[model samples]
Target: MSTPEASAVSDEVTTYIANRIGFIELERPKALNALSTGMIRGMHAALDAWREDPDVLAVVVRSQHPRAFCAGGDIRFLYESFQRGDEAARDTFFIEEYRLNHAIFTYPKPYIALMNGVVMGGGMGISQGAHRTGGLRVVTGSTRIAMPETRIGLFPDVGAGWFLARTPGALGRYLAVTGETIGPADALYAGLADAYIDDTALPALVDTLRSEVFERGVDVVACVERETAAHKVVPTPDTSPLADTRAFIDRHFALPDVAQILASLEAVSGCEEAEWAEQIVGVLRERSPLSMAVSLEVVTRAEGAMADCLRRDLDLTRTSFAHGDVVEGIRARIIDKDNAPRWRFARIEEVRADDVAQMFESPWPAAEHPLADLQG
Candidate 1:
């Protein structure tokens, strides 16, 4: 085996090859490894470079931050871009970010994501692709994952709807509308994470990947499975509240729309899950009504391949920025820290179905769509 030399892929990302494994580390700890346009481009470039490199049999994505694998996209950057009327820059970020997501989804080799902490929004976009690509998504006790875009008046983008929709029963819809934060046990139960390793053991796992030798034609996935299984932490019984509330979630979330879902939750009475339903109702009330409605539609429609979902995500991204409450959401939640957003609709019932339908309509023509090249 040869000693590996690390090289800077960009200011926020680093790439290296060691022991037949390629490693990409997110380096922006100050911002909790938020994905900037540059980071997205750098990651895509690294994957493209290693796609056919025989020496590199697999790729591992991790972060330098102790508190986050990646928080999400650079929302503050997008907020400022919108403030400055830099539509091109704002549009380019989503375009490139979604393309990077597509690359990860379709990567031919093993792509492992060490999801240690704060995997949300754009973070979920990058890491969740491993589940479908025959790769590994390793979570830790510190991992706190959510697609909490609805909280910020934005729908979950970056193919989240696709994966969220595939979760058991109506868990996807419940998560999409309420933007709940779930721990590792729930993540595994929801099919979002593959293994739960103690956070303390992550370094040893990475070291093993970097130093262990393998015979010819050895299975990389199995090698990972063995290493991770050694450190996997079994959850206590009934650890996942998401699992406990599955009946309530499925009953309400499977309704025809967000309005009916909330109404059903409000009507819950004398049941063991009543408290959970009420809490979820309160969460939905705070989120942008339009965003919740749009997200419900997005998750409901995300029934096909990842590529198709990415295409629709791009469309929603464009529409959300252009005509939805995303700008105000970011303004209140991130920029101002005011924690009060004057949403487009004061109540869920006020959100018009036509407005939600308009978001799914692409601004660009079929051939001219930015992600049109992403085929299933």
Candidate 2:
């Protein structure tokens, strides 16, 4: 848990600033920078300190590897706690994680996520929330992002409803349900990424910031341009595989519910994106049936402001874990990787309307709710 040097990260943590640009680099590359409670606490403490510090201006968040900016939250640890029946442990992680998310959303300074690679589920949540709720004003996340939470038996949390509801077209539900990877091109179009710099350019960008050469009206776009010039990944929707993907998504997900949609996809003929539909449909088929249903209910019903949606999300998340896809999916994917998840309900048809109702039933008494103290 060593603290970071000005630009170089330590074994578990790193912190430093040069030219008014600060960075908090996650150093546990082997873990793919998957956030544990310890890591979350470390990041929380670091960002809190930076909030009021004057010398540290714009903060750049990155990691020590190419594989991921962060793969996701440390679900392995959560699964263990989950199996051990450690409610306190689970609550500590989720509560703190959400608190950190809320803080990042409202953080007072410019927070730039150096989303180099392998951003997914929990990774997307943390990075996604940094998009311009506004403090020091320079806030950004990435289309380098992907919220594949549902794929692994989790829902899209961390203001997902907030960001996705605002995303173009019907993409929110498409990504939520299918957990497909959107590259730099789609990332730009989806507003998930602000700038599409090539991954190799990261070191140079860091070096520039570390060199004490920054100026007022410091050209972030120019920096991005210099780095990304050689490898500009432009999104061409006409030529995009996303067009067919989009159509299939709208066709299936646009239906009234998961059951009807799955049935429709199964029966559809001559789908232009047949293979694409089948691939994504397979992902949906692999997902937890009950969790999938709960998510459709949550995302579509998300209303009011981002905060309101998040609060509702907390309830849905808590209830879902108690009775949804998390533990089963975790066992199949991580604990065993057998890919044979014996979901509570074998199929969406088995997920009765009452079952969906029960899934939304909050486990925590109002006073003991996980996010009771959150401002939203």
| Model 2, span 18-94: residue lDDT tens | 56666778877888788888877877887787777776666677875777778778888988987888878877887
Taking all chains together, each candidate's TM-score versus the true structure is 0.96, 0.87
How does each model score on lDDT?
0.87, 0.68
Alpha-carbon lDDT of model 1? 0.87
| Off by more than 4 A, model 1 | 215-218, 232-239
lDDT of 2 at 327: 85
The deviation in Å at residue 167 for candidate 1 is 0.6
| Per-residue lDDT of model 1, residues 1-376, tens digit only | 4578556566799998878888999999999999999999889989998898887788889986779999999999999998898989988999999999989988888888999989999999889988766789989889999999999889889999998999999999988988999999899889888987888888878887777785422366677788778764546414577887788789899998888998998998897878888888889889999999999998989998888888888888878888899999998989898999998889999888898999899988999998888976
Worst 10 residues of 1 by lDDT: 230-239
Report RMSD for candidate 2. Answer: 3.8
The global Cα lDDT (0 to 1) of model 2 is 0.68
